[model samples]
Target: MNAALLIGLSLQLSSCSNDFLEEETYGEVKPSEMTQAANVERAIISAYSVLNGQIDGASNAFNSPDSNWSFGDVTSDDCYKGGGGTGDQNNIHQMEIFNANSTTIDIVRKWMALYEGVKRSNEAMRLLNASTDFDPALKLKRAAELRFLRGHYYFELKKIYNRIPYIDETANTVADYAKSNTIFTSEELWGKIEDDFKLAYTDLPEIQTDKGRPTKIAAKAYLVKCYVFEKKWQLAYDASTEIMSSSYGLLSDFQQVFLPENDNNKEIIFAVQHSINDGQASSYNGSIGDRLTAPGGPFYAQYGFHRPSKNLVNAFKTNSVGLPQEDNIDVLNSDKVDPRLDITVGRPGIPYKDLGVLYSTTWARDLATYGEFAPKKRIVSAKSPFYVTVWPYVNALNYYIIRYAEVILWRAEASVEINKLEEARALVNQIRQRASNSTYVKTLDGTANAGNYNISTYTLPWTNSIEATAAVHTETRLELAMEGHRFFNLVRWGEVDSVMKTYLAVEKTRRTHLTNAFFTKGKNEYFPIPQSYIDGFAPGIITQNSGY
Candidate 1:
């Protein structure tokens, strides 16, 4: 499908409520009529559409906040749940403090959205299998697409709640879905997800005619991610190596990768497709989760949430030779910093965007609580011609799920795990080289150089595997800062406990809200399974995770 048609279909599918899952028929078309190829294709489109369910208004409001922003960023040390105040979105504040419970609304909402995705994908698989009208080749391709999406949904669930029910096409009824725990062991569940992605990797073409659809390379990249999560280092290394040999490459400039004009660039392996003013009355098709992250007041009329932390801002500071001064906060006032900082964050006195206005402290809603920096990567300039005022805060920017740089970084990580230090350094340098090209942020009249903007490749060779691993981890945090992967990355490295505890200790001294924050190693690693799911299941059928 073309981008325009996909946008229209996205809006149409999003309009269906949770009731759509229970309904025997879709509109006037009965389940019997769904045997036609066209209807089956629509079913497939609906499955693909569910991938955007994490966006605000795409699903129920209880889960309206994207977990990427909540669980991924705010829960980590990178961001604060910046809204009206401490009382605003207290559930999120609970998350920031490692105090969220099973009944937390965000947890319930994220669970529902991910399972809804699983259900839709399963429905597509059943429809495709029952339909006789589709060409055999097309059927195989579309089936692969459905399985890829299924694997993607399961992957999200797996990361959030380590143990979950595995439902597929055969488990069509609610009763069947309720028996989730009995069906597979946790290891078996990971194997099942891997099976789907392996099928997708084997069946999907290297490239797709549709811009948003996953390619074979995209499936391979995700498989590498899954292996990394499972700690299957050799498998991750093999899969990442295959992806590195693909046609994808880094965009020369880091800032351009997220711009509206470069939405589906070569750098992106898979992205959640978004379009503005595609006849949706609200911001359903736009990047709505990011609406609150834009500068407040005159900069852009919106709520200011997901404020970047001073710690994150400090992470950009580089020494004389362009290596990160991880512990030297005193050097921040005088040190050269990575150019990507300007691209990722909006600090005081910096150019906010293409707009001439300098980012001021007033742009932050609560300077005393959240730090001074505003998020910039996904924020569209209100002054730009591409800016859509119909939804004012939302825009036609695609949210990248996997990019080539990430693939390189994953390979680098895998290399370090397997003691391939030289290979890891080369991969990390590939990303830094591209970041080095992102030298300046443009102002209305002229461009201003980002703080120092003197990033360079690692000059010193890795002394050992552990040193190389730490370098790869730091590089991942800096390169993928606010894109919502920090907490998960730290967790996968088994560093979240130590890292977050130290982070909170120092951060409390800076931001008073974090004075009581604490991170327990085992208990805080994953979120509690939503209480509603447990209540819905038969007694003793759904066991909650360790802490909650």
Candidate 2:
């Protein structure tokens, strides 16, 4: 009922705790009572809680992780699906290889989790709209927050499944739920999603006391992302301009930005707040989806999933005076590269964090299959109070969905598309300059720099839009690597076909699993709709994607 209790509710929602729903109850607050302010806040918390992608009955929440690790990272050239073996979580491996079909379990489960968030958000909005007992002004703000959440869930659904149903607060009945995925055109769906965020921008406050609540700035940033995905360059730039004028800016230290202690720092506009040992049963409040992402080094749990690829490792290579070498023939260890590489990945012989233990090949779980590199950014220090060393090794580190730096790059991208090449270059230079200023990771003895760090910002002019565009895209890949944005970035830019072709060509030689790998651009651009859900409804409720 109080603020503190509401914060706890946001961290862990009891409404979503059941492993299996009993026949007698739906395990939800009664819709009639949801009109009360106390219940409204609780309902809102329930919606926010699902953003972490922790479904109790779902065996592996990683299938539906809000972070999009499987769909975004493994699907891209950035990572390999490293786990127990080839057969382990094979649904994801199917996605990794672009061999997935409609029945793929990962696709189904991700669809379910995203739709669940949409349902919870819709329920909150319905209650807020129906409530006369609540303060009118506060009710509007709360509804805007729920709408923003709805926009996010819909955004994820739209990205993965392009022709999804646009269900809203009014669709309460069983028959209403049967609305066709084709009810609206793809453009219309984008408009509806934009409408939600636009409303949230108008109503939500500039600041919120709740750690994970969407402020006006957060809504505006999401707008920029939506525009960028839609390729509406002018709209994206205008929104990003407002965000730039705001107080949000980069943190001085790049390495410190990802640490748990800086979870909700100024640099991060929005993130899914993970809480360990919270009141939730079974510690599901922690990093359920990301638990497997921990690289199996000493002072860290040993799952060794989400291994960084050699292609990604080589991508860090820089020429003399700190410029990127786009397909450089440089060995990983001996080459000079960006300092951010050491912070983002754990290679053999580099000190893993500040734990005083050097990362070794022994830490790698299937080194022959996945290579020696492991994911470093997602894993927190074992000594951190937020870490849980239990079976799944869940932690309390928040996954950033939108950071200020991301918006800057998005703005840079928009500027280039609008022929503002010089503007885009300046924006990208901001990101590179920060990377140059950030501290380099140290060796095990703390006496020397880890790897050959020599990253710096561009001093030369981006002569044309093509060059500027390439620079921005490359910077985006380097700046946001391993954060589950790579594949989507390739998709939005229409470069997946060429990029993946080049990646698979070389990667097949390195790893045998990729020997037969290929990406069919049109067919692979978006995943097919889950067949089971379509079957649950009428014959024409949901149409499959082309070539499915």
Candidate 3:
């Protein structure tokens, strides 16, 4: 099971009847009391465990996945909430249509799960600081690791909630977490997340003998991402160039990026490691939250909730010379498209996952509402040992939180913003070069290419920053489509208003469910703070985002 054993053995907290910010402990030994060397290490492992976003007693894991699929992908022009029908997990459907509110169970659970991560991180650091027998050098590394993880948890929270209670090791119990989301300004909160990453970059080793631990390069990569979100183009470019110069680069094939064999391969900067058959009867140690995407037909499991949209599929279209087409044209099955499209989305006749089974249009659970294509990432082969046939249809494939390609794209974006057009074009071309050389999806007999796989790199230098920025953005959407990054990327770029309006206007003509779906400009930029948490405190004790 590799590092999955850590999650299986890591200590977990019991859910209190109140908000997740308030947690009660179990047993006689408090986190401070367990200051032995081995226990301190155990606490470190526990901090990493929550990154997978699995709550022991929570059944609706889709409400809060570490992948950010629902919050990031489905809400944008990337995908749709495809299930048996619209009523299935309607809260997410509401979110998909931008009808979100403070009490969305999905939003509530996401808040709970993120806070649980903060809780574990605080507990682990407490143990580390309290430990009297642990090795000093190892304790420093472990503490840095916990800081990176807690920074990660808070980063996701900030992206989703905009303003969140930034808890750290200083807090211990439920009473200690009475701090409000208003204690720090938005800039200050960003600084706190940045500070953790900076300290982690200072202390963490360049390489780890273990899996899932953040290395110095990983911390730097996260710093680049934080800078990207804050629009600090110079800082993003500087930090991202350092990572690009490091050992990380694109894999020869894009498909290999998500393969189980390359779970923590050289390309992956950080990921929440998943494992199956780990002796957990529920198999929650695996990619439990992503089980709904299994697009079942013959041997595959049957939820099929995260189906790719027609808009996203058309985005893969390539011109005759192999470049992204202008958005005005409609793409067809016979169109000359990018090679990465077939590898990304499952078309009607393309072989799914290189398996002998040809993907049938009927594989889509709800064709009338959602499109025919299903998510191909995060899915493993049926013959693999990691695939488990259970209610969740879980697998051991690790969900990549950050990969080298993303860092490259971030740098490209930063370069374009800083007027380094040629450098940005070269950066985008680097990713495209991998896609052009990479393998395409196989046919039914595995004798030939599945579709018209035509993709090429930028042969011309970009002289215009505006066009160059568009190209970089398009390259990112094509390379990282359906990986739960589209919406957040759009939001950070401040293009959600224009893009969603155009997308909803056109998409409603195809999918009837989006007829009334709309995105309110400033308000929809972020979700509302969960009402329950606000109710638990005084009127001004906790602050809520505007337009809630």
Highest TM-score against the true fold, candidate: 2
- How do the residues 326-385 of candidate 1 rate in per-residue lDDT, one tens digit apiece? 873732535688888888888777778777777888888888888678888878888765
Instruction: Report residue 154 deviation for candidate 1 (angstroms).
Output: 0.3
TM-score of each: 0.93, 0.94, 0.94
Ranking by TM-score: 2, 3, 1
Model 2 score (lDDT) = 0.82
Per-residue alpha-carbon lDDT of candidate 2 for residues 1-548, written as tens digits (9 for 90 to 100)? 13212111222242222221101222355756667777776667677767878755443777788788889999998999998767778888888888999999889878877777787787677767777788888888888889899999999999898999877888666666666888899889999999999999999999987678889999999999999999999999999998998989999999989888788899989888777665565666677888788787666666778989999988888999898887835355778888888899888888888788888899888888888888887778888887887666878788888999999999999999998888888999999999999888987777889788998788887778888888899999999999999999999999999999999988988987676577997899899888877785535767888878
Instruction: Look at candidate 1 and give me any clashing residue pairs.
Output: none
Alpha carbon lDDT of each predicted model? 0.77, 0.82, 0.82
| Per-residue lDDT of model 3, residues 1-548, tens digit only | 11222212224532211121122232235645588887666666666766767766554677888788899999999999998878988998999999989999888888878877777787778778988999999989988998898899899999999988776787645545667888899899999999999999999999987777889999999999999999999999999877988988788888888888778888999888777766554667778778787887887877888888889888998888889985735667678888888888888888887567888888888789887888886678877887887666888888888999999999999999999999998999999999998877877777888888788888888998888989999999988898889999999998999999999989998999887799998889898988877785324677878888
- Candidate 1: where is the Cα deviation over 4 Å? 1-12, 15-28, 54-67, 328-333, 390-392, 442-450
Poorest 10 consecutive residues of model 3 by lDDT? 14-23
lDDT of 1: 0.77
Candidate 2 contains a number of clashing pairs equal to: 0
